[model samples]
Target: MGPLRDFRPPRGILVASSITAAAVTYLAALGRLELLTTGNFASSQQVTAGADLQVANLRPAAEQQQQQHQQHQQQAHQQQQPSGIDTGLALSRLEFEKAGAYPQVTSQRAAAGIDDGVVAPQQQQQQQQRLVFEEKLQELASAADREDEVAHSRLLWERRWQQLWPGQAWGSEPKCQEWQASIRPRDFRSTWVEERLRGLPAQSGVEIGACQLRVSMPDNVQMRYVDKSADAEFLKSQCFAKDGAQRPDIVDDATRLALIEDESFDLLVAAHVLEHMQDVLGTLRHWLRVVKKGGLVFLALPDLCDFKYPFGDRLRLVATPAHFVEEFQDQNASRRNFEGHVLEQGVSVAGIDSLRAASGLPALNRTGNLEDLESITRNFVAMNADADRLTTKMTVPLNLAYSTMEHFGSYCEDHPHNVHFHLWTRNSMHGMLSAATELFRPLGLTFVVEELHTAGRTEYNMQELRVALRRTG
Candidate 1:
């Protein structure tokens, strides 16, 4: 105890000792006297100081942390909901309600851009609903536009179909109905022709030439048949021959016939006969001559463009005169002499001279006879030469020109007598008739076209063109 043995703690212990003393001082300031009254006051003071310090320093911080965590959870919950709801306004309203400040809270929320304080979520919900409504309206508008387009297309097709087959229902004829029932597709033009023919008025008197029985005259009409064959046996042999008992009224040739008087017939019907004539223009002129003024000439012929061959060379069958001559020359001549000269001219002249000499004719008589013979020979030679030149150089238009004689001969020899000489389209037929009118006007033959019917189908499917012409003058 001399100077109170100066008891200084170690540096590490000094820090601990200082902490204990400060803790005790803080506790004593709070007035806990029980610690000073105890015999083990130092130990008790250390323990109590630690407890008090922990409560004072860490409790407020922990509470503050818990409150902040709760706020974060509420914000997170609000964010998870739909975009329409607002958490800040709801929380403010709750706080103000607890504090009993209703009017103030509403005014504050309004200043901060909330409409009616509690109605913020409702406004957001309405905005979202409006956007959805606009999207639905756009979809409906697009659907309506598509429907309108389909309706317009349907109407257009209906109009076109009506125009094509006017006054007749599609596929409704007896023949077409049968075909539909059998599931077989026939050419529609055939049906169209049938309908048109059925619709025609009955004639008082009609003359039909080369009646093959494929088409018939109107019922109860006075009909006259003009056929090339008058022999019953020969007529019976034809495919469309009349019965052996019934005979034709007027049996005459189609090309050259003077049996009927001029303007004798009311309606001159020539079905599929104009194509067989060697001279179509001459035949037409003759027809016009025979028909009465203002009378109808119903002419039907196979359109060359409508015929199809498997080999596609059928079109070439409509040959020019030059083609016929060339072909005939190639087949008949030993040596191809297109100039209308004999292959061996010397032999032919010598044979003629020897024949004259062997006959013992007088010199003057022989000379006269030889001169006449030479003249005859020269005339024949000139005729042949002219024919050759015509055939070689001439080309008739497809619309006006018919089959060559050579083509017809070959066709008769090899196959059936059916041959198409020319090709014609609707426009071509119209143009040909118009040209004929001009060409024959100078000859006092006036022909006017009354009506024309062309099948509405492709060239191959189209069978014929029907033209009704009247001789006006």
Candidate 2:
């Protein structure tokens, strides 16, 4: 039994099995596998019959008949005239062709096309406007398709871009997505980001995102360049864009995900987003592991908490005694309890300032001086004082019974059929950064350097601090 000989199937049985497998594969290829075992073909026959009776059965059948009659009339006219040339057909064909060939309108595209950077009066103004509208529709379509924040952010960018340029057009056309997500690098102020290039001590190379750089000469081009650009248009944009702001290696989460599992980017940019994360520490640890020694991570989060919530139907809103709303504080678990809301998943956003300081990221990486905590808090207060915006004004009127003035945090949780998991404030953000400096001090992953950035509605708060952080081993 230990070394038993294997038995083979009979010739006839083998042939039958092969035939069945082949038939199954063939039917599957034709997308008719269900027809093999079930009366699916018969069901299709019923649908086919209904389609045939489209001219006879439904109310639309009358319209179909009229269309057939019109087609017959058109054929009759074509038959009556011996010429193949049809001016009407030519115009219709041209329009259909134009629909696909025409580039879509985005702010930059529109700006590029317009005279004096404004919509020019043209007979095709209507067509251009339609293109702009389609661009908006396309963005919404993209948003609907994506479940994660990455694509959502793109739509946010699209909305903001559209607002900036009303009749803008997109040079690139986005089609139905193929993957779960793609990587996007945060915008770099200067292409020349200083980095200690791996393998070369004290050597720094300017890094550029895939969007801003192109590689040429196939034999000499790099794999990174290949992933960045494949077509001439992409190559041109990445290569020829103005301002020689030293291109740097810019990679997004999805791209980095392909490179490393359970890892975060060396250069992380949090733009009003860190507050959304339930566990800031867990996320921080993940990024710290993969980032090269001396590489930078950046953070920029909203200081306000009026727009966050939990994740379920039972998620209820709680009232807090304060001017601030108790939106899900990724730092605080229970809306009512400051401690329960502390961590979402395994990450904690507490003590960011101490974490950075403990790790070694001092603002004085350039200035060569350590930032004291008192100075940090004063800076945080100053930043908040300059960056804060009051959004207590509701755009839509709410009944007094439903409205909770100071307890507006419930608004985010109650509306949209779910509650957020965290609420962040300028105090919390600076506090978390400040806190992480102490909390992360024991964890061995500390920030060596930091750059601060704050950005929001230009009308509300123009004070945007973009922080780039270097990790000290």
Candidate 3:
């Protein structure tokens, strides 16, 4: 049976097997064709996967670079910016930072392809408003500082005023009758003098050249007197000598004043005496030495600008011209003629040092001859004529003879007579006192002018300036 089993298959079975094999081969071939036909789709899917992986790898680096660029831009902007309070750079920075305030600036930046990186318009406006508020705050601080300085100055001025006037009002009417009772010739009473006396404290005092009157000292107040003359005959010749009386209690030699103790007197009254001294500063130093600290020194002088002589209505004449003529004329006169004023010119703040230096010049011994006298007279006549012509233009008779006689009698006299050396206005006197204090401060002398008054020339009064000074040291 095993030998007989090796026989061939049936034809139909072989045909079925062949058909199956062919179907399998055909399916394999169809699969290869499908793959060749869709080759691009497969390749694309693979490429897409690779691209996704590459993107994931580069993302962190790109984000880091962008962050670095943004940081660089922010740093550059901060470096270019200016501080709020930098005055020198504030204007330009304001224009740059608040560019939105000006429409043209925005347009210019946009045209130039430069982005300022400002925030929205609303936010920029808010930032601009904040800067303006800060500037206003700075201005207010400056104003406050100035106001404080002004307030301090005002306080200092008030304190000085209080020290000067004390209990009395600045321009108050004084008790003239009590102070002027002893002064003879009521026509010579001065309101300024009365005011000065009334302001003085009631204390021990001394008077230089007390001809007949003891000024406003109370009955209890003690006083020592000084004068240039001790002789009875000379005392009787005084203008205030009513009954040819002599003052036996007075000490002579007013220049030295050796009898008075240093810093002993509380008040020093030199009504019209200082102008006659040869060394005015030396006399003032001596007088200051005798007066105590915080004591008063009352001075009264004739106002040079207000001439009381009868000059027929020359109202159009400039005051400066007449003043210059008088000053130069006195300067040319001989020193022996003590009748001539040594300092006839008005004292001023600007001229104090020059005047003091001039006072040191050697006194000339030569007397004025006839020619000098004639020269002065002729100059005076010419000045009077010019003044008359400029002012009135009237054919009024010029009293040239009387004027020349009066001038010669006053300054060119042979004998030594009382004559005003220096003249003063209220401002000039104040300046003089201030200049003197500054000049003499090194000598431990501190003089302060407390009050100054100038009386007007009325029918009954003579123009004069009265000053009150206090010795602080």
Candidate 4:
């Protein structure tokens, strides 16, 4: 067959090819056959050269991907819970747990009460008038970025509320107000006291840095780290210590000891510092030490019992005042300049009375206890301008410097009287003064009233000063 152009395969080889085709067809018919029934070819199984082995390798990866997707979905579902709702619920529960109504109150919280509710409409109206002394306080505190002033204000307000309204109060209710006249203002026996704070002449000879502890003037403009221009007249006279040794160190609340020498200060003026102190007696003792026997300490503070900030109602609420006067020089403040004080609560008065009784001021329990404040007026507390950090950068202000006069003028008027944890009445003032005197008396300290230029909170017609006599053995 002429080497037949198309050679016919041997029957055996042909049959083998046909059988192979048939096998291929059969395998195709059973497409994607897997060794196991789990819809995946097992990757661990060894296989001859076939597509099944390739698919098996991919199956494991596919299954892993599906599992990962499911896990991701589950995790996502758990993340969508509301955290705020849970936190709010917890806070609400706590508030309710502490909620109280008409509980006996002390300090500023006493303003919220409902005992003997009968009162005159006009009187209530007068009591409702709000006085925000904190505006000025914030201005002063913000002036130097001092947060303590605001904190002190909160304390002052709380005690003030309690002192004005001595009764049961709710914890969360609005505090009610009482007429100024309702809580009769405690009058001092002007004629009974022998000592009086004498006003300083506008142009009196003054020298403050001759003593060992050099006098530090105020720094109102530079409190924020940037020095702002001040009155040229005031700035020109400033005696800048070469090392600024007289300035307060920001690191410690006290003056840097090394920087100070003997007899640096003949006068120490702090405004509204006494109110925030916990241990007034101890503080006074230390003050006596810091002062050079004859050096004077100028002070200014609020009388919550004499001002009306009916903080809240019902729940022995705390009206954290701008400050609290745990101890002070006196309770008798003039009502001419400052108004709307509410010192009705009796705790402060009692404390003051007790203190006066304990002291042998001689004038205590005298006729001066029941008269106008003109002769023997006093504010509730004193302040520390640099209380937070001891820094000479802080400064006093003109308005603050005149606090004594302004407060005295308002005090001479019909300022509302309120409550306080501790009120600084004439008796209390006498006690504090007596305590300070006792500590300083041994050092031969003399009390001489002078004019102060401090700004934080003190402003008055008179300031006290002490001069050290020649040291005795």
* Candidate whose lDDT is highest: 3
Candidate 1 or 3, higher lDDT? 3
Which stretches of candidate 3 lie above 4 Å from their native place?
1-202, 245-248, 307-413, 457-461
lDDT of 2 by residue, 322-354 (tens): 212222123343333322222111111111111
Per-model C-alpha RMSD:
48.8, 27.5, 46.3, 37.0
Instruction: Give the lDDT of residue 205 in candidate 1.
Output: 44
Q: Estimate each model's TM-score.
A: 0.36, 0.28, 0.40, 0.24
- What are the runs in model 2 whose C-alpha is more than 4 Å off? 1-266, 305-420, 423-425, 456-465
* Candidate 4 lDDT tens digits, 200-285: 22211112121112222332111111011233332222212122222222222221223234334443433233433333444444
Predicted structure 4, TM vs. truth: 0.24
Steric collisions counted per model: 2, 66, 0, 107
- Candidate 3 scores a C-alpha RMSD against the true structure in Å of 46.3
The Cα local distance difference test for each model comes to 0.37, 0.30, 0.39, 0.25
Q: Which wins on TM-score, candidate 1 or candidate 2?
A: 1
> How far out, in Å, is residue 468 in model 3?
0.5
Candidate 1 Cα lDDT to native: 0.37
**Candidates, ranked, lDDT:** 3, 1, 2, 4
Task: Tell how far residue 229 is off in model 3, in angstroms.
Answer: 2.3
